[model samples]
Target: MSWRQARTAHVTMTFDPEGLTPTQREGDACVACHKKWPRPRIRIGRLPDDTTLFACPECADALLPQQDDTHSLPWRVAFS
Candidate 1:
């Protein structure tokens, strides 16, 4: 995908409601950090297995693998 398409896809994926209810968003712990954020909100995404995960931006950065660099690497290097 082009940069614009990649960026758009990232935005769409990152903005998913994290499969949360209003009450859950308010009270649920981040799947990574295990803490509920107050202001703004946590981002939600799914695993390859279609299991949902929630994370704060900080935790997300640490929890999610780096797609940008991975995409640019050879398949072997990307996996290694």
Candidate 2:
């Protein structure tokens, strides 16, 4: 599939939390690698409970679409 399709697929997907640790379920760790030191901040998905899942930059890059600045407006500008 193309990158756009892959990104769109992930955007609407929610992850199951049954297999995750407490830290991961709480968003204190990387959902993909379980790394907690730097703290994962990228929103990757959500649990059934609606808790947000996170991942580090490296893992997020692998999981989500790369931001295209040329075709997209920055959030502030877009919102304004």
Candidate 3:
């Protein structure tokens, strides 16, 4: 399946290997498409109220903005 523009910029994926388990399964459905996902890479999005929602890779990619300028923002400023 092809990925589309993002729905929002609050989406993210976890990379913590310690948090994963062989028997662990993702029971949450994609917030955008409402489809069940079994894959280990779960997508999470933050709501307006700060609540986290899970989505599939397709949905996450589809929901992300195509050209967001905020990505250029600096995390820290260099002292002069």
Best by TM-score: 2
lDDT of candidate 2 over 1-76, digit per residue (tens): 1224333333544898889999999999999999998988777888988888888878877887665557666779
Model 2 steric clash total: 0
Pairs with backbone N, CA or C atoms under 3 Å apart (clashes), candidate 1: none
Per-prediction TM-score, please? Answer: 0.37, 0.67, 0.39
Error of 3 at 22 (Å): 26
Model 1: residue 49 alpha-carbon error in angstroms: 8.6
Give Cα distance to truth, residue 25, candidate 2, Å.
0.3
Candidate 2 achieves a global lDDT of 0.77
lDDT of 2 at 62: 88
Model 3 residue 10 distance off true place after TM-score fit, in angstroms: 6.3
lDDT of each: 0.48, 0.77, 0.46
Give the alpha carbon lDDT tens digit for every residue of 3-78 in model 3.
Answer: 2234334435333323433223233556656565463144454444444556577765665545554544443652
- Clash pairs, model 3 backbone: 5-62, 6-63, 6-64, 7-63, 7-64
The ten-residue window of minimal lDDT in model 2 covers: 1-10
Better of 2 and 3 by TM-score: 2
Sequence-dependent TM-score of model 3: 0.39
Q: Which ten residues in a row have the lowest lDDT in candidate 1?
A: 1-10
Better of 2 and 3 by lDDT: 2
